[model samples]
Target: MTRISHITATAYSCPFDKQHQLAFGLGSNVKRDVVLVRVTSEEGLVGYGESHHGQHPTAMAEIIERGLAPLLIDCDPLDNEGIWERINRQQLVTHGLGAASMMALSGIDMALWDLKGKLLDQPIYRLLGGTRKKTRAYAGGLALGFLPPDTLQAEVADLLQQGYTAIKMRVGDTPARDAMRVGHIRQTFGDDLDIAVDAATRYSLGDIPEVIRYCEDNRVYWLEEPFTPDNLEAYAELRKRTAIPIAAGENHYGRYAFRSLFEARAISICQADLSKSGGFTELKKIADMASAFHIAMAPHTSHSVLSAAGNAHLLAAIPHGILFEADVAKVNPFRTELAQPPFGVVDGHIEPPHGPGLGIQIDETMLERYPAIAGPCYLPIERSAGPTG
Candidate 1:
């Protein structure tokens, strides 16, 4: 049995060619952060994966370099689930389930899966029983925000021209503006198109009802993270206000927290990020829970290719999988260069990686090209007002 020979986590920051000015949530993404973890087998095989940096890439990398790597070094890489349990029982217990710890473990879990697929000489999807070759995907653009109505309409039109049947646009710029954008898009495009609005935790307690009414009247596919996951009570109440699917989970870390979300009955769709949630190990348990509850799933993908490929494999294997989020940003090196072949959306759907492992080969040059940029990449809090639970 080959044991994990070496493990290291490196942080990278890729600045967008132009800053992404969002109406809310991380208000303007000037740069994207990702902490990549590499695990080497005793035989010299290597695998790569990424962790959601949460605007703190350096800190997340320290957890892997100083905390998680030790637990994994001598362990068998193929005991995928067993290694996950060991990490949970050891490091996670000692560190507590904080964002950095969870994100760090997620990176490790993903690397092990990539290594496993390589070991088995099969792609991750094929190893997971190969649910489907391609899964339906929607354009996920951070640029679609509280811009002018013409700008917003033009953005939608351009995406549709690109063959995207569905798209997600940012809301929470005030209920009136959000409502008008949704209504205009629906009126212009008609019912055949799918439109999802992500509030990005920019709404007040009072804003919930107005947004709900708008979604109900206009047919918004899902109101994503209308409020932060911390406000479970608000989410439960908001669920009663509308029939449009309430989607969340990218912020949620593990299955224990998801159990609470399921109990709350607040979310109709669970949108976990593989690199943030718990990678394949814990995600399988979460997906199983969603299946039992009949809740649909839509995995969130930012700019990390590792997370994107990991998400595609999970989406393909699960029965409840609906769609995967694909970043449509103009400049995203993490999405383009982190993986050798990168990810592509063909015919409005993404074809699963056919390569062994995450179906991605880690490009070492990204380490030199992107490096780490300092300061917060998310929106400044003072710039954001209204209730934040």
Candidate 2:
């Protein structure tokens, strides 16, 4: 019958070469913790999945091992929908649907899909109705911040040389500095390259007009996350005021949150992360909804190889798929440690990965080498309360 026998999860923390600087967040030496879920069947075949553990590896692992594993064990792994439904019906856990619970579910759901693909002898994209087209990629996190203007120019040159037709730069250092950098990149790269800017939600509603105008004048393709996800009204205002499309939804999780964004007309480009948005189960729904609105999905990719692989397959499946975020950060685990570093960008396009399921193989040795180090890599400044009352 190929019943699900057991599910096991482990966490790993990998260090980055340097601090990853963003507008609202600062990550010192990319402390990436990945949760690897192993789903074993009665027939003895095993399928693997990875969840980007981010700041909560132990919590995520505990959820999978203690909370989810008990319910998942002895169930049929082939009945993905049934299993997913059972998990979703857990009132206690499903209420928030974020943080450790969702992360654990993401891992389990991926492993379930992986097992299904292995059982059916097909790749995940094929199972999702085959490829629509080659997944296109854009150079992401191209080292705009913490570098001199000349060094930034050199980095852009390297990205262009690496066959990237499009690239996104981190902004929000200072509006004037950002404008100068954008102008420099535009002038240097010319109008041939598609340049996008991400403020990482550091800007307020007042900052949007200037940023949008600057981006539009400089011929920037898109401006991402100008305001926080909670500021939908600001996003709506920004959308109304700007010619430059606003890209968001990476911070927003699930279809419910995205539907609100769509209803509000707050976002033009949807950048859902498979790892963060409840895995493929929910992300596919989100993609379909975005497609109905004629919105393009340029999925936000960072962290694990599973995310990259899963996103690549999803991109191949969705007709409205646009650009994939290729992390250009040197210390990114996606490039260094993750199982299948995505197909190298060739002429601005990424070829879909070919293998059963997500096509990612975990390096257990490497996984063990990087254990969880102390410190919250993404603690917000507002939450920096001390031990004293």
Candidate 3:
């Protein structure tokens, strides 16, 4: 049995091609943020994973380094379940931890799964019991938003040309503004494209009625995160307001968090992030829970190959996986630069990366070219001014 020898985390960021904007409180995104983790086995096998660093790159690096790394040394890399429980018991249940701890554990858990795949000489999906080798995908660029209608249309056209049958656009502007953007998608493609909208949890119950109406009227596939994950009542009410499926879970922490959503019948689809929802262990539990409730699985893509490959593995294994999100950024250095052969789409589907593990190797030195910026993410609400600005 290969024992875990060491753990390390690195943070990176690159300025976007052009600044991007979000609705609700999020103002603009100046850079792409990422934090990556590496787990090494005593036999010298190395596996990589990506944490949710769009929000806290430096802090996540620190937590994984100081808080989690010490606990991982000498643990069996194959003891994924046991290590997960230990991390959960220590960082989650014991400390009453929240997002940071969960996010850090999520990355480490993925590293272990990757390490397992390497040790067994199998792809992570196969290790996860997958029958399929490829998974359906959708374009999920951070670029599409309530930008000028023509700008958004150009972004949509390119993705369509790339053979994506489905795509997601960001929302959360004034209802009428959001309607115009979503309405353009319907009119531009007529029925050729499947469109979904992510509100980024930017709306109140009052702000969402019109948004819900727009989604329904325009055949929006689903409305994602119209309310925060913690707001179950609002999510349940939002579901009742429209026939379109309600999707969330990226912001949700664990299977326990997802259970509350299930109990409320708040979400029609579960959009768990393998890295953010407690990696493979917790996500499998969440997927099973979603399956029992007849909910679809549409994973949220983190902006790196490590998480992207991880998402694909889980998507291929699960019975309920409906869609895999891919950031359609034509020039995303983050995705292409990290993995040996970065995950790519062919005819609107992603073949699970071929390798013993995630099929990705973190360019640890890439951290130097794109060091983490120290501050809150630029996404804002009410934009009165915050650390991001």
> Model 3 clash tally?
5
**Model 3 lDDT tens row, 1-389:** 67889999988888754444333325666677888888999978888887887477898899999998898799988988899998888888877447788889999998888888889899888888885467778988565865678888888888888889998888776677788888988898987689988888888988876887888889998888888778999988877877898999989989888989898999999998877889888898899999999999998888788778888888888888988898876556778887655567789998787777887666665567887886655655453211211
Q: After aligning candidate 1 to the native by TM-score, how far in Å is the CA of 133 from where it should be?
A: 2.5
Residue 58 deviation, candidate 3, in Å? 1.0
lDDT of 1 by residue, 1-389 (tens): 88999999888887764445454554767677888888999999988888878778888888888887887788989888888888788766675647678888899888888999999888887777765567888999456766667777888898888888998888877787778878888998999899999988878788877888889888888889988888899888988877889999999988999999999898999998888888888888899898888889898885577888888898888878999888887667777776676676777898778888888777787669888986667655344334221
Candidate 1: residue 314 lDDT (0-100)? 86
**288-363 in candidate 2: lDDT tens per residue?**
9998898999988856667667778888888888888877765655456657443445677876667777665656
Model 1 error, position 193 (Å): 1.3
Residue 295 of model 1: what lDDT? Answer: 89
Give residue 290's lDDT in candidate 3 (0 to 100). 93
Lowest lDDT sum, 10 consecutive residues, model 3, at 380-389
Query: Which candidate, 1 or 2, would have the higher lDDT against the true structure?
Result: 1
Give model 1 RMSD, 1 decimal.
Answer: 2.8
Q: What's model 3's TM-score?
A: 0.94
Clash counts for all predictions: 1, 0, 5
